[model samples]
Target chain A: MDIKLQKVTKIFQAKDKSETVAVNALDVVIPSGKLIGLLGPSGCGKSTTLYMIAGLLEPNEGRIFFGDEDVTDLPPEERGIGLVFQNYALYPHMTVRQNIMFPLENIKVPKQEALSRAQEMADLVGIGELMDRKPKQLSGGQQQRVAIARALVKQPRVLLLDEPLSNLDARLRLQTREEIKRIQRETGITTVFVTHDQEEAMSISDQIVLMDFGVKQQVGEPQFVYDKPINLFVAKFLGTPPINLFAGEIVKNKLLLADGKKYRTETQAPEHQEDLTEDAIRAMTHEVKVPICNVEIMDKKAPDGDVVIGIRPEGFVVDEKGPLELEIFMVETIGRDTSLVVKDPFDDNKSYRIIIDSSYRVKAGDKVKFSFKPDKMFVFDKTSGDVL
Target chain B: MLEKQSNVKAWLYLAPAMLLLSVFTFYPLFNAFFLAFLRDYEFLLGSARGFTFLGNFINVINKPDFGIAMKNTAVITFVSVPIAVIVALMISVALNSIKKFQGFLQTVFFLPYVTNAIAIGMAFAFIFHSDYGLLNTMLGWVGIDPINWINLRQAGNADTSWIRAMFALLVYTIWGGLAFKIMVFLSGLQSIDKQYYDAARIDATPKRRVFSKITVPLLSPMIAYITITSFIGAFKAYRTIIGMFGESLRPPGALSKDSLITIVGLVYDSLAHADATGAISEAAAASIILFLIILAFTLIQMQVSKRRVHF
Candidate 1:
């Protein structure tokens, strides 16, 4: 089933009569049979969005639909959704087989048939031999598999997983995530996975929806969203060692770095430029106040205004005679790549990091002149955090 | 060599508790067993009489009220304890589900547990009175005749009427037993993860099925605990019965033998009535028998729990 949300909102009321908007007017379209990741940090409403889709939580406003069927008021079971909780909530008293067969019990399936189906599910999850073992007797990963088998035995139209790999050890998390992806593919259920781990989401999900503070930030193909983020938050959230941020401004159609140097310019539209209007762009650009930290001036000429520069770690190209100069503060060789921890020579506390080839023998105090790939640079209106 | 020294240190730490148990518990327990095998109480007077083996046991068994007391105790324990556990389980499950005023309701349910059992038993006695009691009045509202309860004790009545008096006692016993068990089961239910019920709800399991399959099995350990404790408690029922029925069966103004009695009551009666030479032996034998019965029941329950308890 294709899951669609039309301005769904959920407000949680507190004991003192205050209210928290857990999911604020969220809207998304989860294509049928595709694993869509709801990625965000803690308290970002990703889990709330997933739960609303699963019908475990009702939206305070707006409508939810599964393939054009209005299901805003439907309960979880009636919505044909299988949800695996964060802790993999298996019934501790039951054997693996019994846990898998639990959903079948109330449906009047023949006892033998239900048992056989449960066995099949266990085998599918590769725990067939452990059918008689209680949940407490199983290892964490094994118990996780049992929980998945139990959720899937009913053949739900949509599968909702709320941080399913959060409870596993690092090695098991990777293995079980692959297992989950494989199972979802075999079943071809419309799956909505929620997690704070951007790497996991990018690796496993076909589509990733990044959210923050109860608002949707970006939604697109994982690589597409990563390569061309719509906002500052998306850029900051999607990378390992994180995208390096520095304060800068456009001046006289030239990019100005914080150390008082004006790099050459070539005017270019941001990746999300088509969706923005001239007035909206002006309003976004007019809001930023500049020159807060070290700035890498892109070749792209933007209107003269305060902006935030986001550069992916790999965006740096080390050159002995490049235009921009950065004094190397430290060198960290992390197996595959060496990270050049550089700081503004004028302001020592304003440090900027860039990754280069580990084979490059760079040392601290070396002043390296560098230039950036124009496409790798993300220009954002500082105040509104919108890509410029 | 160091492990041996640590072991001795651990034993030293345990010395006070072990000594206390040996003096107060183990000594009395072994003495009871030895006394059960003897019929002479001359030791109480600094005189010696050899063991009479089964004589004391036979003497106590032959007393006419012995059979009545045993029957009464068996009936009350078997009937009231199970009913108490079931009622408490249901109430606790219901209490566990609701959030509105849950603490208030729990406090209300737990009130009787903290209150004196004898006081509640007396209140229940008034409620179950024959002519003008609260129970008969309620039954009378439904057109049932008022019962002969306390009157049956003062003046011997037909066998059927005596059963009514016993029924009155059962009602009080079960009511008094409910509060503590309910508190225990409620806490157990509260400690269970809410996620399991959410999972069951998504599975669309029916209410009754959820209760039997999820709630009951998950609660098996607590259930076993409540059941064994309740059975043993019922077996040792003393103050509640005495409070519900007056001191000597008949009230202060009446003229008859006590109609309602239990094993403890019979043991007390024998201790009070026995000639000086035999009193201690007879009382010890009766108590030893009661202890053995309780131990046997507890062992049987433990065996059942081994197979069924989930945790």
Candidate 2:
């Protein structure tokens, strides 16, 4: 079922009577039968949001709905949600079969039927033959599957996973995450996955909700949000080796990079240009001394002031005649892609990571000219961290 | 080579404790076993009139009060242990769940453990003292006549008086037993992972089902431990009774014999009259019987609780 949160907020009162907001007035529609990832750094309220959805936590204000039903006051047992905690939370004393059948015992399902349903869930999670084994007797990955099987045995409408694979080793984490995805797909449960790992969220989720502090930042398809970030924070959070940032300015109608004591105009748009065609900007510019990105990607009428420029590591292409020049601080080559640790001469000698093809034979201290891929570059208002 | 060196060093570290145990604990234990078989033994005179298997046991068991002591000990053990275990389990569970005043309440329940058992028994004796006692005064307020709880020793209403005396002893013993059992149970409850309850709650389990299926099973090991220990403790109860009924080991006034005397009481009474032929041997024999009884019951308890315990 589609889960809906309308201005849900949760505030925790510590022992000393100090109140801290864990989740703010957040709004999101988790589409039915699709996996949604609540992605953020630690203490960013993603897990809090999942817990509220699972009915394990009550929002101090606002309502939660499962499909059409307002379940704000309902207890967790009535919510029909399968929540798997980060630790797996398997009953240590019970065998896999007993743990799975335990939930059915609450609803008074016939003993024979409960046992069969438990077996079915165990089979679905691929722990069928291991039902007789206790939780500790199984490996971490197997135990994780058992937790999932037990959660599924109740046939809950929504599946909530709180960093479910964090307990497993690296290899097992990969394998178990695939198992979770497969199980969720086969069952078609509306699963809400919470994780601090951006790659883990982006790799599996149909839609990813990025959050910071207690507020929602952006929510979209993983790649769409990565490629077309709405703001500076989104641009930096959703990349590996992180997005490269440099301080620059938009002087008059021209976006210029501070090249030491001179303003090197990358591209120029008409004062009120709505559609900034790259050809039009190039035609109006003086003789092209260096290769640079088209300024058309910037929002129209972007105010002329200091701005933060964010570029993905993959956004750079080494060209001898490129507009931006940087000294290579270090060269780190790992087979397919070589990451050049470069120092931007324009932005206070800040270090930046730009992934280039390993085929380049550049070494440290060599100055390399680089050009930007238009879509991969973003301009943001410096103080407010908003996209310009 | 490294392991051998560590092994010798470990033995050296354990030497003082081992020496103490051999002198005080192990020597007495073996000596008792040897004396129980002797026809007549006297530790003071260092004499034994040769060995005769079961002679001392048979002579001791033939005494009329020996059966009574056995009956009294059995009554106390069987009645007090299960009641104390259940009550302490409930109290500890309550103590574990409450958010506020937990430490204060735990200290209150645990007060009896720190106080000497005999002191608590004396206090209970005064409460059950028939006239001008706290119990009788409360009973008076409830429109009941003062009952002879521990004062029937000088009287002739034998069966009723004995039952009342037994009741008083059970009450005193149960109160003294609560503190340790509650402390053990409270610690056990604390160590249990709380997530299990959360899982049960999400399953929409009823409170009763949660207690029976989740809470109790998880506490089964502790319950078993408390059960076996309380049983042994209740079996070896003598000092508390002395505090209540005094050196006579009976109720007040009309005592023709030491009523409510436990097996340990019988053993001590026999040892006091060590001048009698075979009396010291019989005391050793009585203790051996008590040991056998405890061992047998413990083994049975271990077997019964074995299947249920999670660990």
Candidate 3:
């Protein structure tokens, strides 16, 4: 089912007559049969949004629709949603088979049919051999599979998972997530998965909704949001070895990097840097006396003012003749790539990172010159964090 | 050597609790078990004639008062404990469902637990007092004649008086002891994760079905605990009746020791008449019998719980 929340808000009233707005005027449409990820930090209202959709919590302000049918006033049972909690929440007293069959029994399915359907769900989750075991006797991963089978046995229209993989060990987290994706596909149930792990969300979700402090920050394909974030928060939140930020400004038609060097915006076409001459590239290896050029185009949309520069670690190329220089402080090699932790040459108070192919023989104490890919760089207005 | 030293340190740390338990709990238990087999107990000399295997048990078993006490105790246990458990469980479920003034309701229900049992029994006796009592007065308002609740001697026959006294005692016992059971069940119900109920609600399970299938089974451990303790507690019912009626037991002119005497009351009566030849022996035997009955019920409950309890 396609779930829609229109101007929804939830407020929690505390004992002292104070009120907290947990979710504020949130609106989103989750299309049917697609796995959407609600990604955020701990207090970001992602789980709150999922619970509202499940009808566990009634919105204080607006209506909720499940495939064009208003279900705001309905209870959870009438909404036909299946929710798996962070702890799995299996009935400890019931065996795997009984736990899976409980919902069927609730709806008064015949005894024999309920048993067979429960067995079928167990087999689907690959726990057919462990149906007789209670939840306490099973490993964390097995327990998770039982929880999933229990939620899916009734074939709910929308499946909700709240940090389902948070309780598993590292290896099991990976394995169970893959299993969840497969099960969701096989069942073709619309799923809303809430998690704080960006990698987990990015790996499994068809669409990722990033939120912070009860507000939706960005929503798009995981890679698209990563590559082109709407704001500085989105840019900083979605990547590993997170995008490096620096205080920057535009003055006299020159982009002034935090490191004091100034580059004329019209010196070279940013699109043609890959084909630069070898000597030109090698010339970038020289000292502070030589200045670098043709790095990237300053976003024309940005008003002339103070801005924040965002450079992904991968955007930096180790060209000896490139425009920017840094004093390498440390080198870390991890198989395919090497990380160069360097002192910012122009700004004494800051440091930057450049991840180069492991084949590069850079060492600490070496002064390296570099430049960024034009496509990989972003500029945000200092006050508003809007990408320019 | 380190393990030996640590073991010695552990024992040294445990010395006070062990001393207290041995002096207060274990010694009395063993002494009672030994005294239960004595033939003639002389309280003046603080000695017994000889160890007579099951002699005291046989003597106490043959006494008419002992029989009446055993029957009365059984009646109270079998009647009041179940009523208390069912009523308290229902109250706990109702209290747990409402959020407004929940703390106030809990405090009101739990007031009886901390209040003196004897005080509450005295208050209950006034309410059930027969003439001008609150209960009889309210019934009189509805055109019903005042009923004799306590001291039912005016009812005329032995069987009718016994039945009336039993009914009056049961009402007080069930009412006086409900608070503790309600508190236990309420805490048990609260400890259960709200997620399961949320899951049950999503499954569209009916309220009665949820109670039977989820709440009951999930709370079976607490239920078993409450059952065994309530039965044992009811078996030891001495104070409530003493508070309601009196130590003399029968009213101004009673015929025999037939009114409302519990096992503990019988034991107390025997100990009070300690100058009699076999009085101490009979008291010890009665104590032993009460212990055995409680043990038997506890064991039966544990067996049932092992089969049905979830955790």
Candidate 4:
């Protein structure tokens, strides 16, 4: 059940007479026997892509293939794809056993065989004793397990789940996500799961495809995508308390702040700026160097133009005699680490966040200075929003 | 003082409906039962009415027409209610699957329930006419001769020639009664959660199995409701049948020497033509019997409903 989606796109005509591109030119190949997650923010088309893969929704363009068979035109039933809806759409009238057996019966499986398979699925999902209970009689988690069993009983070639654990409470969601991963591994079935929660996706998926605003932002292993995000959106979307971005320019090998403070960087500066006119180079230099500070400069170069620097909270280290100073506005102490909200010296209206050890004492109104590891700094072209 | 006032205000809120129910519903039911047990008495003659328990009841059982009328009512109710419910269920399922013009189709099916029964009866009479009837004309096109449908009022109509007209009248009555049942069934269908169907499809349950296992069971409450209502409606099939068949005949052995009659028809006849004391008493007894028969059917239906209802 190798699921492949080629150049898939979906445009929805909203009730307000506007067209929303739900999935734009998306392509992904999910290998059989792996649990893959499509993760993104709300309205990012992750669920739309999953629905298209399940054959529940028709994409405006592109094709889907399961194994060697092109099933883009097939209906959900004909595609032999098992789908678990977000709300766990279990038949309310049927008992757990009946719900699990329903699909087998539909495919005209022998009654005795269907019953045995249903019982086996029910046991696998851990609802064996609750076989006689109707859906409404079961708890939310129990009902969800029944729904999963019902989907799996048919032995579909591929399984599609649309935010299956989203309806559960926090503790249950965590428990169910683990159980789903275990089941996927045990069955060795190709599964596509959709969720807006990055943690859930990272925890369960063998590979993750992160999406934003109908476009594929990045796709890789959980750690790979998290550590080396393809763009700012992916970087910000994957982390808790997103990465911090600053307005700065690169001059020679030093990154210059908007207030003209020069910070040394190991990153090589682009070579084309060496040919700029004297005035242009001077203007760039002035923007990088602070007028108030006769600060010690380890390196200097003619600044070229403006660039935005991004830094994750974890990237900054608080130290005495650090280059950047800040006034602490709020402190959040969470057992493992403490997050500090400090005012930005470069912009009066803005505040930047920094994470420090939980043992460090920091309160509102405390003044602190921070220096970031030069190698960890990310400079982006401000106008283009591309990494520089 | 505040709590006392709150209690008083609660009672005030409930007072109107309570008063209305006592006056309109409870009072009449007890009064009907009490009237059924009363012996011969005359208010105009200033004579005291005395209690005679089971006296009128026994008299009703003795009348030969009583058995026949009871059998006729049972036949009509049994034949019409289940058929109406089955037809309504089919129509409702069809309406549910129709994506386009669904509202229009629903309105068409529902129109009969709201339309005047007299009008429906008249229209059906024309369609079922022995000579220029639409049904007979269609049958003729298919190489079948005209059927005197209104004259075949028995199960063995081919042999029981005497019951042909009555049976036709029964069919006409059933047709006139179908609109309301269909509307009820449609509403019931709409109320079912669509998730069940989706789950069934995912499970690979065939369409027919889904309908039987999920749709039918979930729809039991609606089926029960329609069954009771249709049965009651069938029992009250006088206006439609009489309107179609014309109103001149009376029962075969009426004391007033009439030809065609029903229990209610006998009551009307007794009140209008025969002013005899015994005749009036007998009519009252027949009314009581009709009431009891409907009551017994309803009670049995409710017991069955309680067992089968899903929610």
Candidate 1 displacement at residue A132 in angstroms: 2.2
Between which residue pairs do clashes occur in model 2?
B153-B254, B154-B252, B154-B253, B154-B254
Off by over 4 Å in 1: A259-296, A299-301, A343-351, B1-20, B152-160, B249-258
Least well predicted 10-residue stretch by lDDT in candidate 2 chain A: A288-297
Report the lDDT tens digits of candidate 1 across residue range A82-186: 889999889887888888998998787899999999999889888999999988899989998998898889988888899988999999999998998998888
Query: How is the predicted docking of candidate 1 categorized under the CAPRI scheme?
Result: medium
Instruction: Kindly list the interface RMSD, in angstroms, of each predicted candidate in the order they appear.
Output: 0.9, 1.1, 0.9, 1.9
* Tens digits of per-residue lDDT for model 2, A53-93: 87888999989999999999999999998888788888887
**Tens digits of per-residue lDDT for model 3, A59-138:** 78988999989999988988888889888888888889889999999999999999999999999999999999999999
Candidate 2, fnat value?
Answer: 0.69
The CA-based lDDT of model 4 is what? 0.75
Model 1, residue A374: C-alpha shift (Å): 1.7
Ten-residue region with minimum lDDT total, candidate 1 chain A: A286-295
**Which digits, one per residue and each the tens of the lDDT, describe model 4 over residues A182-264?**
88988888999999999999998999999889888888899888777766677778766777777666566566654334333
Best by DockQ: 3
C-alpha lDDT of residue A13 in model 4: 95
> What does candidate 2's lDDT look like per residue over B41-153, in tens digits?
76678788899999999998998889889989999999999998999999999999998999999999999989987788789989998776899999999999988888743
Tens-digit per-residue lDDT, B226-278, candidate 4: 78888877775567656765564321222222123456654555455334444
Candidate 3, residue B253: Cα displacement in angstroms equals 4.5
Against the correct fold, how does model 2 do in TM-score? 0.91
